[model samples]
Target: MQTPFKLSLSAQDIACERGGRTLFRNLDFAVEPGQALLVSGPNGAGKTSLLRQLAGLLPLAGGRLVTDGADADTPIAELSHYVGHLNAAKTAFTVRENLAFWADFLAEGQGDPADHLAGALAAFGLGELGRLPAGLLSAGQKRKLALSRLFAAPRPLWLLDEPSVSLDVASVKKLDGAMRDHLKAGGIAVVSTHVPLETKFTHTLDLGLERAA
Candidate 1:
């Protein structure tokens, strides 16, 4: 029985190496209440790895990470919701059930569970499809289902990776609006995308130019 060494909650000077290839290094960023950060980079630029560090899913080779809002950093797992490219839900569960699962998981006296569910369903135009199993939904509908988690769970920060993929124009608008509302509510978000976001935020970090050695 051994208690392994665990990394910090958040990281500065984050770097990663895969397959003996250096991705990038000396990265510094933080998430704050009411602030949103967009991580823009070319494919294979370590955007996901950077997020992994923040999410505490990967061990940092070197750096200091924190969650106390000290030096403007916080534990990503505690401060934000990380939405990766994969969606793992009981596809057989109805759309409402899917949301309800998350709503229930993250609902610990923050907001009323029912209110969050209603807001998510109505806000995303899924009121009629609430009972439909997620597997039966269209691609765009599934994407919407995926996006609904943001509203159901209240976190101070958000780590979204390529949220615009497979989304139609209307759904995209809805997604953008939801994100805008999230930012307006004093929540911080870090998003990675190749598509030009319609968001009006002036603060963004472009990792696309980071040269790999």
Candidate 2:
């Protein structure tokens, strides 16, 4: 997949807060095109809050979030794909339906959404389970289904929070491959996870250390 335009994500002296408490302050990071940023921290260090801020789901407590090389009028959220802690699949819908819905809503490229459905499923080794109901899938399978959205629609920025949560070893490898392919295509990824991923990271931020200092 190719990005519609060149882009890079950067933050200067960013901070996060929840419940009137500051999590981290004076944090800085940059992710250029074709690079990944790995966020690590102990519990309550605000990894999820940081990702949410990047995704535009939460307001930044301080500092600026900047994207270079994109249109000034374009919102960062429109250029990003955020897969948070929860798998946003609708249980009653079939796996295919869930993916198809996301493909239609988040469509960016040419052709029909249906045309990308099968390929998305195949990308995550969920080819045969498309017909199954989403609720019937195991934890790992659901995670893959949620991840298939990356292939279903092409986006330059990916904000993934604990994406490896329920994935098995092989599934995690698949996830790594998908991320690698995205990076190879000049996409950027910001991921938060406790487990080590096979994906090669260009930069890493340890929120725990940031808070300690």
Candidate 3:
């Protein structure tokens, strides 16, 4: 897959606050095109919060988040794809229908999502399950379905929070391979995981340490 888009992510002394408590502060990191940044921390260390901030779903309590190589007017949310803990599939929808919805929404104007639908299902071994209702899929299958969107549409930045939650070892490997392919294509990934992944990560940010400081 040829990735014609180019973008880099950087955070400068960022901070996050929830309710009345500070989750993390003075956090900083940079990930260039084709690089992956691994975020690991103890529970409640704000790993998800940090990822949310990068995804533009949560506001930073302090500091700057920058994306280089994209149009200055482009919103970071538009240039990035965010997958959190929830498997956002609509249970009432069929496997392909669920994926197609996301592909169309995320890849809006990029291309006919149908062009990539079959390939996305095959990437995660969901080809045979495409016609089944998502509610009938196993937990792991649901996760795979959620992840299929990463391939259904190509985005410059990927913000994944605990993406391997329900994945079996083989599925994890598939995810790693997909991530590597994305990196090789000049895309960036910020992954927050407690389970060590097989993918190559160029940088790591430990919010646990920041909270301890």
Query: Candidates' lDDT values, in order?
Result: 0.72, 0.88, 0.88
**Residue runs of model 3 more than 4 Å from their true location after superposition:** none
lDDT of 3: 0.88
Tens-digit lDDT track of model 2 for 1-213: 444437998999999889999999899988999999999999999999998999899999999999998888878898898998788999999998998888888885546787677678788888788789999999989989988988777778999999999898988898898888888888999999988898889899999999999
lDDT per residue for candidate 1 within 1-213, as digits (tens), equals 111112223347867777777777776766555566778778888888777766778777677666654235434565567777876556889999999888888766666888888877876799899988999888778877877887776776677888888888888788788777777776667788878778765467666565542
Across 1-213, the per-residue lDDT of candidate 3 in tens digits comes to: 645668988999999999989999888888899999999989999999888898889998999998899989988988888899888899999999988887778887777788777668888999899899999999999989988888787788988989999899999999999888889889999999988899989998888887888
Considering TM-score, where higher is better, how would the candidates rank from best to worst?
3, 2, 1
TM-score per model over all chains: 0.85, 0.95, 0.97
Q: What number of clashing residue pairs does each candidate have, in the order they appear?
A: 4, 0, 0
**Residue pair clashes in candidate 2:** none
lDDT of 3 at 104: 79
Clash count, candidate 3: 0
Q: Between 2 and 3, whose TM-score is larger?
A: 3
User: What ranges in model 1 sit over 4 Å off?
Assistant: 1-11, 68-75
